[model samples]
Target: MRNPETILEVDDLRVYYATPQGDVKACDGVSFDLRSGEILGLVGESGSGKSTATGGVLRTIGSPGRIVSGTVTLDGEDILKYDDEKMRQTRWQKLSLIPQGAMNSLNPTMTISDQIADVIETHEGRQPADALRERIMTLFRRVGLPERIYSMYPHELSGGMKQRACIAMSIALDPLVIVADEATSALDVVVQRVVAQTMLKIKRELNVSFIMIGHDMGLMAQVVDRLAVMYSGQLLEIAAVRDMFARPAHPYSEILIESVPTLTERKPMKINEGITHDPRNPPSGCIFRLRCPHAMPVCSESRPDMVEVHPEQLVACHLWKKDENGSYVRQSV
Candidate 1:
C-alpha cells in the first residue's frame, strides 16, 4: 500500500530532564513520521521515553525538562520554532493532546459543556451561546457521550464517560493530529474496548492522524497501523504492525513480541533474566546490549545506525550486517 501524506515529522529529537545528579536523556535522538489519518503506536516499558516523546510533539515539556535539540514539523511547519503565541494557536486547532489519566484531567466541579466551551472560546473567540452549545453537542455525539450529560459535572459521569468527555475537549477544535497519551489505559477491559472503538470511529469519520502512547502491545495492535519500539530513550525498531509481529528485526522488538501471550500458540519465551535498563547511565554502545542474548562485541563498542531490514521496517542493532549498498541484511541462523 502506498504511504499516506506525512502530517508530522520528528528528526533527531532529544529531550532532557535536569536533575542534581545529571541530565536524564528522556528522549534521545528519537525520529519518526506520523502519516495522515494513521494511528501510530509508541510502545515500551515504563520510563522508556514514550511519554516524553509525546510531550515533545505537543511542546508541553514541563519544568526541568528541556527539548535541547531536534525539529518537530507539524503540517509542514517546524513547531519547535513557533513562538508561545503561535504555539497557543497551533494547539487544539492544529495539534491536540489527550493527556494520560484523561478521566482525571476533567475539572471536578465544572459541567462537561463548560469545560469544552473553555477550549472553543479560548481559541476561536466567544461564539453565540446557541452556536457554542450546538458545536459542543456535535462533539458529544461524535465521542458517544449522551446529550443529557452535557451539563452534568465530571463527578456525575463514570470513568469511561469522563474519558469520552476529555476526548471531546481534545477534538473541540478538530485538530489534524491527536496524541493519545495512554488514553484508555485506566479503564476496565470492557470500557477500554469501548474507548478504543470510539477512537477508531473518530479516526475513520474525521480522517485524523493519531499518536497512540501505550505499553500494551496487544491493545495497540488492535488499532495501530504501525508501531515504533523504544528503549532507554532510543528507537529500536519501527514497522508495520503485522510485519513486526511476523518478523521483528530488532532483538529487543522480538523479545517484546515473545513476552506477549498468544491465543493460538503457547511456547516458552526467552526471558531477559536480571537485565535492567538504567536511563541515567545506559550501556556503552547499543542501549539494549546488556539484555540482548545475541549481543556481539561490536554491540558494546559502537552505536548501530537504523537500517531497513525489510520494506517499511527499520531496526537498529549490530547483529545485522551491512550489504554493499549499506543496507541491513539479516545474519544467517
Candidate 2:
C-alpha cells in the first residue's frame, strides 16, 4: 500500500547521455518515493547513477544529457511536464536543492545574508530590508550558524559552516522537498556528524522530506530512515535501514553491506571483484548480471522486476521466487 503521506514519486525514470557511440543509459527505469518528513538515502558506488537520477528529478541535466522518460510527481503534480517558467517558479518554492559542494554553489562576491536574501527576493518579490534581515538570521539560527557569519563571504566560512549556510538557503521558502546531493561529503568526520544532525533537526522541526545522495553507508545508517541501493543505472533494492542492514534481499545489496569495514569482524572486500560493462551498451537482461555472483541463466535472458521479498522491502533480482505460501524464498542455482 502506498503511504498517504507520500510527498514525491519517481516512476520509470530513464536519463540518457548523448555520445558518438550511442545514448548512455545513466539512469535506467529507476523508481522510488519520498514520504513526508522522511529521509531517504540513495546509496551506490561512483557512476551508479545516483547523481544522474537526482539531476533528472531536479530538471537540471544539461546538454549531452536528457530525461528520456519519467514522471516526477511532487504533491500530486507531474513536475516533469512543467514548462521552463513554471519549473523555475516551482524550484526553491516547492522543491529545493542543496548541492554537493557548498563553496561552489555559493557566490564568492556576495555575503551569506545577501545570497539567501537574493533567493527570497527573486521568488517572493522584494521584502522590507529589516524583515528580510530577521528572516535570514532566523534561518541561520535554525541551521546552527552564528549571526557573526552573516556578513562573511563563502571563503570566510569553514566547509561545515558553508554547508549549513546552504541548508539555510534551501529552506528559506520552506520547500516541501529538499534534494541534498552529497551535502556533507566534503566535510570532516566530526563536521559531517554535526551537519547530519542539523539536517535531522530541520526535518523534525519543519516536517520537511529529503532525498540525500551519498556513498557513505555509515552516515546513511545514522541519518536516513530508508536506503535505496543502485548499480549500473538501476535500483537493486530499497528497504528500511534496519531491515537492509540485518538482511539485504539482493546479492548486490549483500555484497555492498559486507564491503563496509567493521571493528568486530574482518571480511574480504567483494564489491570490487566484478567486471563493469560499458554504459553505452549494457547487457540485454539484468544490468548487474555481469558482476553478480549468483547469476543464473534466466538472469541473462530477462530483466527482473522489483518484487516485495519481505514486509516493506523491495528487491530486483532473479535469485528470489514466490513459494506456494506466497513468501519470497531464495532460488537454488
Find the candidate with the highest TM-score and give its number.
2
List residue ranges in candidate 2 displaced over 4 A. 266-271
TM-scores of the models, in the given order?
0.95, 0.97
User: Each model's RMSD to truth, in Å?
Assistant: 2.0, 1.2
Please provide, for model 1 over 48-133, each residue's C-alpha lDDT reduced to its tens digit, 9 standing for 90 to 100: 89999889988999989999999998888999999999999999999998889976788887889998999999998889999999
The TM-score of candidate 2 is 0.97
The C-alpha lDDT values of all candidates are 0.89, 0.93
Off by over 4 Å in 1: 1-4, 264-270, 273-275, 324-327
lDDT of 2 at 60: 95
Winning model by lDDT: 2
Candidate 1 accuracy as lDDT? 0.89
